[model samples]
Target: MKIYFKTFIAIIFGVSLLGCDPAEKQNKNEEFPILGRKQFVERTVNGETVVDTIDHTIPDFRLVNQDSIWVTPKSFENKVYVADFFFTSCPTICPTMKKEMLRVYNAYKNNNSVAIISHTIDPKHDTVALLKDFAQRLDVEAPKWNFVTGNKEEIYELGQKGYMVTAMEDENEEGGYIHSGAFILVDKEKHVRGVYDGTNSNDVDRLIKDIDRLLATYNEPKTKS
Candidate 1:
């Protein structure tokens, strides 16, 4: 079985956005597909062979937030979050990404079950104080939206491997760094459910709606065997 990665999902998602009707596309009851390569493991269950599905999840990370508070998976425990990579000095898409992210922040600002985390790829320049000021300027705050910085290698690795997005330094690129402007939607279990272009307002609008859809998943009745 082949791993269905984000690139493939992105293309498919873009096509759906163009081809589908908003009113009929994503029903409130429809569950978002977990976006990532799933693994299958064979197991013996009551003397029978069974294949188990293992979802792709965000890996553990330790980074310092704007408030100088250490942030980890534990910080987002039991909550669905939106995540992206950016730096304060970025001269290109970062501004648009943040502008769109503010909408997400406001939509769920009062909803404690939701949160947002942004990683700065240029941690050397994007210090804790810088991130603090950046968030303050955006009129966002911690626990609701966290702008974080730490070891550049760890941030890049997490962005590429964990979030399945691009994050790296490139002198040839503007602002001396390059990263994906995708806002990733992670479920309560840290499973990625969707990815949208943070620079696109239409995509962000869809993301806002998807967040509600994702949250609704938790309110459903549980099934018992």
Candidate 2:
């Protein structure tokens, strides 16, 4: 499953440059594709056996944010959000990632339809107090940008199986851990719609534009078949 997920991610990165701007290659009315592995379930429909498709989604999670509020999937109900994994003390790419993320935070800080969540991979070192101070230094607050920490194993599981991103401790790597620099874009339904390199300005720009595109999807009027 990990191999399949990685291959899909490789494909996304491979063609990202060509399709970064949906308006350039796709109809403006077209919705962003739901990313991640999907499954085919057999079910009975009108007394006939039919196969149903179920797209991958971010599973339920419970983590405490900097403000001491219990953050859960319910916190993002009826909204689209950007999610990423990082620790406050990361020495290598985290600084750049957060710098780029600020662009995203400033873009949608006031937009209630969007939100951002950052998970700390180094939970032991990144305590709630540290995360709070970290958010203060960044000049960001919750409900707009949430810096959260929780059980180390649960966080890792969410990062890997739920968000389909890499997040784990690696002593050999700089900062004492290794995690993906990709920012995941999840829709109201919890399905991942896009992923961007959080350390790259150009990619972050694409992410900002994609957020607008994704929000527009919600405003689109429903049509009858």
Candidate 3:
């Protein structure tokens, strides 16, 4: 009787180890999904290539430019751009941010290969007229530099979703909206290559080097082996 009881106890233990409850195993298996794509490069904060996400298609957006021109994703389809998120009314870091961008604008103003997009976080107060005025103050030439404003929700979503930049309204802060001061370097294919501190010349210098490297890569002709 003891031998028979021991055999039955071992069998029960083995089955329990495999699945104490079959229902829980099925629920856990359903939660995991396979990684689908690896289209764009994702680098570490220190600028090392680590893992890349598969979605390479650039996100779509629509807004009116400084010239009151309706601009869409296609406007930048074949060009690289250093993008930043800010509002004209910002009194803290925005002026410094704009100064850094001015250097970049001066650097690439003559080159038709690259562009700049300064998107406003506060679209309600920053109308097309207001954006136009802001562009003029910064000497943002038409077709080269664009100051854009649109539906508030859309622009905010672009910050969090598209650019992976942060822009959120903080009722507790002095200014309603808070945003990062990084300049995002994007390729012609619409993939973000690097992000740099707009306030730091050293970071911007590195960003410039990367941008030049990327442009050269696209322009270079393939040599026959």
Candidate 4:
């Protein structure tokens, strides 16, 4: 009877160990979709030649930030960033999006590796001075969070072709321009790792969780020096 009981306890212990495995837990993180180009020819692996799938990345852009500084893709080099479109005068979904973005800002306020880039769809009205005032009103500091504005056509092209979001003018729309209420998650390599609805609390919660996961990918296990 003692031998049989000991074997049963041992089996239970093994099962519990398996259930608590960290690798298993980590594997449960939902993999965020990569938006943009599917693949590209990297280089010839050998004389035999090889092609590699391309991870679509946010294209290079130059726009003036709240501080009246020219912000470019290089500004976010080796950093993960959240991106969205909003104008200072927006009266509809932009307010909700900004509220949700504040949640993201609070989460990574002190983390230098994280940043947020908000572009203005109505660049004509959202000039650098106007953006600066808007950022101040929102209690956001420059460099960490940038409210950028530039050529309307360029910004629109970036919204559609670069970030895969909508940004266009419409007379019937409440805000005058129609833009997506999405908060885009970009990795250190400029790749769009995830897209969350900026107006939904639940989606923003997932965005926060996924940001941690995305950061984990960069925190590779260090080797003993």
Which of 1 and 3 is ahead in lDDT? 1
RMSD of each: 11.0, 11.3, 16.6, 5.4
Number of the top-ranking candidate, with TM-score as the measure? 2
Q: What residue pairs clash in candidate 4, if any at all?
A: 39-54, 40-54
Specify the highest-lDDT model's number: 2
Q: Tell me each candidate's TM-score.
A: 0.85, 0.87, 0.74, 0.84
Candidate 4 lDDT over 89-183, as tens digits, reads 89888899999999999899999989999999998888889998888998998799999999999999998888999989998999788899999
Give the clash count for model 4: 2
lDDT of 1 by residue, 78-195 (tens): 8999999999989999999999999999999899999999999988888999998988988889989999899989999999989999999999998998889999999999999999
For each candidate, what is the lDDT?
Answer: 0.92, 0.93, 0.81, 0.89
The order of the candidates by TM-score, greatest first, is 2, 1, 4, 3
TM-score of 3: 0.74
Cα misplacement distance, residue 165 of candidate 1 (Å): 0.4
Q: TM-score of the candidate numbered 1?
A: 0.85
